[model samples]
Target: MARDADATKVRILAAATDEFAAHGFAGGRVERIAARAQSNVRMIYAYYGGKSGLFDATVAEALRRMAENVPPRPQDLAGWAGDVFDHHQRYPEVLRLSMWAQLERPEAGAEPREIYEDKALAVATVAARPLSPIDVLVFIYAIAQAWQLSPGGLTGLEEDPAGGDGVAARRQSVVVAVERMVHAQP
Candidate 1:
């Protein structure tokens, strides 16, 4: 069978996403990505320039998926928080990849800034009380991600047939926190 360049690139990206998400930029290896992709290192370099480029592309793709999957709703920040929590639950890799990017490569292109600025502007426009748009946006995001970072448990997550409401309870807490923040904005 003949090789298809587009398919090869897709495979490379998917593999890179996994490798980079798990290992981060400094630790992520092009060879692992190539091996996972069932292709060669040369293809990765040719398609993405190098390891840095592949990491950038993988992060960009994760952010793109995140924005598309859980779009910000300035008017309904609480609902948006719930959606964000749900998105994180479904795609933890995306959040991990983002965290890795922020730690390893803090500098970002205008695309992320633009997205934040747009959301902040909308949040400011709809906010009941006078508030810092950036602060509000950041708070909402932090609240939504709280449960993902911690389940309010000392022994990890809890589970019981009697009153085990780990995921649901955590999700509800995230939504309620964002709601309270939105309501209490000043």
Candidate 2:
């Protein structure tokens, strides 16, 4: 069989995403990730250099996928908020990995500032009112990702927090909150 380096790399990143999402950088195990990817630890280190490099690659892949699936809707920031909520809900691993990065790599810093700068600039150019551009983008993101950060991942308002009407209601709440913030006069 022809060796497929790209496919191996993809599998490694996918495995790392799930591992880090569930257990975070500190608790995530390289052996588990290797088993999940069907790739040896040596290959992982060769491709990513070390556990830290693997974690960075995993985070970058998650964010890249998110950006592709949920392109910014700066003009309709309210709708954008709803999209973010939906995106995170569908691919929760992305959100979990991000939280893990924040907790584990506080000094990573900027988080690829160009992406954020573009997003904030898009919002700022379109909506030049209320809060600053960066504020609007991040607040919407926080509202979208808040459920993941909630203790026990339950906001106390839902009996079955991750399903049915509860999720819909929470999503609506996120959209509404962002709408209010986007519309609030300075």
Candidate 3:
């Protein structure tokens, strides 16, 4: 019974991720998420309280998945940044969800604190020189996600009009930038 309940929750979260990514918090429809998850509205409320709760849960789950799958490797910041870029490309929904959270729900609860602490420690230990771990992490994340979030704004000005390999080029640019940032003196 517990297994079945967990499955139902997972289904609901997956549906909510797609719904929120497409429509955001204000525009997202709980009824649609229920339909997509094959679960009723009451069940959503029972599990997640309401639309806000569901959104929070969806974002939390997305972050958890990313951390588990693409944890930062401070010793290899460039490789880690490349992996992050790939993950963002593959799971663009996560980035969309984050954007919505920032724009629409700035007051939302912070990301898991322990994750931040662990990442900071890892980065501090392997840093080439003294640097704020938080700053390094933020820099790497921004470089990796900037293109995905705003390709036209970020890469359009300088990129060739007919560049067929934009993604590859941007990814390499991100890795190089991360390497430089990690190694540069504060």
Q: What's the number of clashes in each of the models?
A: 0, 0, 0
Q: Give RMSD to native, each candidate.
A: 2.9, 1.8, 2.5
Error of 3 at 155 (Å): 3.6
Clashing pairs in 2: none
Task: Give a tens-digit lDDT track for model 3, residues 70-138.
Answer: 998978999999999989988999889988988888787625667778888888888356557888888
C-alpha lDDT of residue 113 in model 1: 67
Q: Give per-residue CA lDDT, model 1, range 25-120, as digits (tens).
A: 888989999999999999988988888888888888777878877777878888898898889888888878888878888875512666676777
Badly placed stretches (over 4 Å) of model 3 are 1-3, 128-130, 151-164
Best-fitting candidate, scored by lDDT: 3
**Sorted by lDDT, highest first, which candidate order results?**
3, 2, 1
lDDT of 2 by residue, 1-186 (tens): 887999999999999988999999999998999999999999999999989989988888888778778878877888888898889878989888888888998676514566677787778778467678877777888888887678873486668775788888888899889878877877
Ranking of predictions according to TM-score: 2, 3, 1
Alpha carbon deviation, residue 133, candidate 3 (Å): 0.4
Give all TM-scores, in the order shown.
0.86, 0.92, 0.89
TM-score of 2: 0.92
